[model samples]
Target: MKRTVLPFVLLLAAACGPRYGMRVPDKLVEKLPYESRIELLESENDLALAIDTVDEASNEVLRARDAIRRAKARESAAEEEENRAADTASREVAKLAIEEARARVTYLRAKQRLNVGLRDVEQLALRCAFARYELARLQSTRKAKVEGSEKLDVKKYEGQVSQCEAKVKEERAELAEDSAQEKTAREAWEVKKAALAKKTFDARASPYVENL
Candidate 1:
């Protein structure tokens, strides 16, 4: 709980790639009574934010689709790499079969390389938990002077802590899921490889037996 800075989530968000600015003109707010105008403005802001989010997500999807198409259309496209494993709705179904892992090419590539270890996952989870603890400690402290100055909002701090806890839960879930998937994949691969080796050995020894 005695951390020196904000949680890594906030820092990571700050360090991530640039995002398109979503500017909604203030002129969209209607002229009305104080309370009614405030309500209208808030609603307009929420709608604008939602619209921006959808637009960004749509653009991302389009970019991903286009990239896949380009990869498929390339002259040097490998046979298995260019397979249209799934369009969109069939991705979940495609995962059940392992022949052409077009959608999971990145995962396969990472599996072939050095990847994050369990210790990293545990460290991140611990840091997030500590961040939540620190937030709770701050909220529980008797420092009302900061609140009196209109700088500290108890509700806001509580919300931040809640978000941190949710993140901790999410990290744990993802870690568990990834670990299970890795174990399953390795087990299946081992079974297949052992069978293939046995068949190969038998084939090589078959001609010798016939000659004898």
Candidate 2:
């Protein structure tokens, strides 16, 4: 009976073993910020690479948004070009019916998609802002908690605290700049879209305007 119970207990232990291999406990990994840090680029080549990286990352996202507006404008122009060609071929209706209405709708949809991307980046900026807010809150309360634990008293870890505050400052500044650019990009896109709508409307309605 004892031997049989031993086997059953071993089987239970085996079943209870971790299913996805070994994983570091969260508590252990959580304190690893001190160990891992971003190194600032120093070499000339590294600086150039950093610029390229920035262009590809944040700058490219904004550029892609601008391109969407341009693409929609292109489609609207293409419609007018086709209508012009049709007018030259035969003047049956005095104006070839162009899909200006549909073009505007498509442009609007593209803008909406870009807006979604813009919002996502905006939220990301907000997240960074929140992180900075938390750090600032912790820092502000440190004087009162100076007698408390090492973690509570910011002065106890002055170097680390200052470094981290600097980190937050840099991150907040970068994110704010990005948010501002995103806002500007959105405003520019809106202005272009509005102008395109009016221009396309005029182009499509010109034949009737000329007749009147």
Candidate 3:
């Protein structure tokens, strides 16, 4: 009985030991202003990264536009080829080629617009999140000052806090609207892709089907 009880106690101690060790430093850090500072820095870093990503997305939209132009040319050429084909099988093949090129153009155009909307949403989301961290840091610093000094005038911080709060609220609203716009854009792109995919598939399979 004694041996069993000792092992059980040791097992429980091992289970709790790591968590206790972790909590001590976490609690110590929570007492300092460094946590809020780190949060603000991270938010800034995220916003900067998001801006770079938006720029890349813009470049992709340009590339997609170029591809779309090439695809349209291919589609027009396929139409002319279909007109010149002398036999039924040859015409069917050219028709399928036209459908494929048309599909590519449709996909590229929708994707270009979707990328633009997504980047706008992403930038707005990061801006909204950064504003929250900024407000948190401002409030934390104001609290620290009030706690550390007996003569600190609380009214001095109110104006700055109010402005930060207003900024956060405004960005939050804009983020919501931007997210909705992105969702609508994505849905529209999906609809276009689905319709084009069905059309292209039917064109490819038409030669294999027998008349009823």
Candidate 4:
């Protein structure tokens, strides 16, 4: 039993000795060199990624600023275009207003002239009616006085009455025509005046704020 125990203890001591011999000394070994290199490489890689992120963010900011500038420029251009359009519209409206006013004045003048002519025709018709009535009364009295006494004179007077009647008829027709023409002229003037007045009101109330 003693011999067996001694041999086993010697074998255990030999195994422990070889195991201790396989380990390197602390002073001779490169301590944690691979781990330290990996750590430094990882830190440099992180810095490169951070720089790339910053560059991308700066590019985005520049793009946004450029877009904002373009938007403002477009807005300014649109405003200028609107103002130009308004100015053009104002000029056109003024020209139209002037033309309409001239037309209205001309129509009014024509209406006044027609009215004066109509009054003259009416007075002429009145004079013609009075003359025809007096001629008719003279013919009736001459016929009652004598049938054969100066028959030629009676025929002459009858012819004069017929001529006077024709004249009165012509005067009445002319007066009716003149009255109709006067009414048409008056209606035309009123229409033009109304249209011009409405246009003036619209111009005053418009957003452009310019008189036409």
Candidate 5:
């Protein structure tokens, strides 16, 4: 009977184990400050990556714009030379259309990337603000708990807390604008992608479509 009961208890434990995984207990003192510091560090690292992404995306946008300009110039030259030869002009125009479409796609993708990077930066900014608030709250709590200490008095943490609260408010205020910009980027990308998809379909369906 004892062995059977032990097996049943082990099975119950195994069934419950996966729900929460391993739960590590924290120390009783100053957990909020410690956790907030960790979050702040992580957000700062992510913000660095987001900035790099924005830079790369900006460069890609420039390259794509240059490509579009070159393609347009070539198309213009081809149009001017159309009176000399009809067949060659048609092929050249088709080729330039494809090139322009591809360049536009690249530009749209770069824009989307930039938008995502900006959104990430805004989100991380908010996260950092919240973390700062948490750390300040912890400091205020600790200071209030201290007794007979001139350096760490009850009123000492108020300024820090107020500054952190202001930062949080500023971040929140920008959230709506950030969201709108991201939405605009997404909508533009989708529209351009759909239009380009139709052009691609038309080009593929053409029997005259060649390597160019």
Candidate 6:
């Protein structure tokens, strides 16, 4: 009876050991699934870090482009300002040149008037000299006639004196007329010259007064 009972107990123990070994293999398979999930999560995190780095690089590039654009705008504005200044300076120079030309013209006109007046005075003086010479000749002949000069041709001398006196009177009237004309011309010239002088002075002083 003891030998038969020992054999039956050994068979039962063998059956229970097979069942427990099967459960251990199943648990190891479950742990493998969890390890695979953890690996997948790590890969996703690495992909996100790569994307973030790319975004940062793109932002830097955009910032550099904006800086370049701003610098170009500033340069263009400076160029425009310089151009405006140059245009203004050119206009000022043109105005000054025109003023100088006008001044020169006024001076020339004044000089011409003075020259005309001087010429007229000279002509009047010449005419007066001629008149005085003719009067002297007529007086000499009349005095000779009154002194009874017998050798001299009386009719011829008297006729010559009369002709000379007439010539003297005509020359005197012409001289008087010329003198009056000359006086008028001189007065007009003086007035014009004074005006011209004032214009020249003003033109020369304008730059100083304007502080140009």
Model 6 spans with C-alpha error above 4 angstroms: 1-151, 202-212
On TM-score, who's better, 1 or 5? Answer: 5
User: Model 6: per-residue lDDT, tens digit, 1-212?
Assistant: 13533343234334434321111111222333333435434333433343344445455445545544543453454344445555675444434333433333343344334444434433333233322322333334334343332334445434443554465465555555445654565455445334433443544343312210
For model 2, give the 10-residue run with minimal summed lDDT.
35-44
Backbone collisions counted per model: 0, 0, 0, 0, 0, 0
Off by over 4 Å in 1: 1-130, 133-151, 170-181, 196-212
Superposition-based RMSD of candidate 1 using all C-alpha atoms, in angstroms = 17.6
TM-score of every candidate relative to the true structure: 0.30, 0.31, 0.47, 0.33, 0.34, 0.25
Clashing residue pairs in candidate 5, if any?
A: none
Q: Write the per-residue lDDT of candidate 3 for residues 140-203, one digit (tens) a residue.
A: 5555553443233334334443554465467555556555655665465444444444444544
Best first by TM-score, ranked: 3, 5, 4, 2, 1, 6
lDDT of predicted model 6: 0.39
Cα error, residue 161 of model 1, in Å, equals 1.6
lDDT of 5 at 138: 42
C-alpha RMSD of each candidate structure in angstroms: 17.6, 17.3, 15.2, 60.5, 15.2, 64.9
Highest TM-score: which candidate? Answer: 3
**lDDT (tens digit, per residue) of candidate 1 on 1-212:** 11322243334334422321111112322222344344333333433343344445455445545544543333123343235644542332223223222323333322322134333434444434433433433333323222222334446545654665576577656666566665565555444334333433434243111110
Off by over 4 Å in 2: 1-98, 146-149, 152-212
lDDT (C-alpha) at residue 32 in model 2: 32
Summed over model 3, clashes come to 0
Residue ranges of candidate 3 with Cα displaced over 4 Å: 1-39, 143-212
**True-structure lDDT of candidate 4:** 0.42
Error of 1 at 91 (Å): 36
Per-residue lDDT tens digits for candidate 2, residues 20-131, read 1121222432333331212111222332333344335555456546655665565565566666665453332222223333333444444455455544444333333323
